[model samples]
Target: MARVSQEHLDARRRQILNGAALCFARNGFHATSMQDVLKEVDLSAGAVYRYFSGKEELIGAIVAEVLETVRDVQECAARESPPPLPDVLIPRVLAQLREVKPGTLGNGEWVFPRLMIQVWTETLRNDELSALMTAGYVKVRAAWANLVESYKVAGLMPEDVDADAMARTMIALAQGFAAQVAVFGAASPEVLRDGLRALMSMGEPRVRP
Candidate 1:
């Protein structure tokens, strides 16, 4: 047999996960099974099992991917030299998610966001998934809180504002937008940007120069 490159291994893994996502999106996470994934990927049960032991494992992997996406955005904030403006960071990250997760609503909708929402909905029953998602959301909220604190220090935010509460509001808005897209269809990037602008403007009153 020809040597399988690391690239090939990674591709195969994604291929299986993509198939699993389709099944979960169509049937919901609790209803989807390893057999469904195998059929979707058109791969042998043996081949698929090598990557995931069962449906739970597959869903876990997908959940991890979603968490990583949020973490990646946080990393951008922590690493950037000047860091992005609050308005820019919120809309930009939400827009990126909207762009990347195309056809998740199925009919010409994105996939990633839909998959995320499926897992999120199922989290109501799955304690394991619930804990994982909750932890990820907490980390993301903390990162946003820190970002808000930075803006406050730079005199861009109001002194009396609560960084933690404001950050939660911002993140909650973004999360709501993501859920809307996953359930309906993709929204215009301007919608999120405009919303963020309005939210952030509360802190920066317009000055008549």
Candidate 2:
């Protein structure tokens, strides 16, 4: 047998995961099945099985993809000269929320945010998924914590500001936006950018008055 190229393997895995993502978005994870994914991919049982054993593994891959994407976003923001987060990071994030990548299920639909919401519910039942969420949360929190600490050190933010809480607030904002998109359709990038700017202008809360 010819050696499978890494690119080919990656492409095939993405194909399976994207199909599964759409299925989860359409019918929540509890309702989704390996058979549904098989139909979505239009692949032989052997072919699909080679990539993902079942819905469990598929869900894990989906969660991992999200964490990986977030890490990439952090890395991208860090690489910029002054980290133009609003000018750069927000646009990239909006693109993911928009599901700019190819592979449509039907009728030009994109199911990323809804699929993510389903994954959140699945975490309550699956220990593995819950663990993945916890671990990913820590990584995300740490990334934001570092960013927050930098502002604090620069005397931009208060010294007593809780980095962890601030990080969670940011995460909450992003998740809330995703939830809205998941329910309604994707909004224009400018709309999201404007909203984020307004939220930023409010500034991180210091104490409840």
| Candidate number achieving the greatest lDDT relative to the actual structure | 1
Candidate 1, 1-209: lDDT as tens digits: 99989999998998887778778877787787777788888999999988899988888888777666766786678556566875678677766654433334346666765776887778999999888888888887888887776776766668889978987887777778778877778786578778777765675667889
lDDT of 1 at 159: 83
Cα TM-score of candidate 1 = 0.83
TM-score leader = 2
CA RMSD (A), model 1: 3.3
Candidate 2: worst 10 consecutive residues by lDDT?
A: 97-106
Q: lDDT per model, in order? A: 0.76, 0.75
RMSD, one per candidate, in order: 3.3, 4.1
What lDDT, from 0 to 1, does candidate 2 have?
0.75
Q: What is the lDDT for 173 in model 1?
A: 74
TM-score of each: 0.83, 0.84
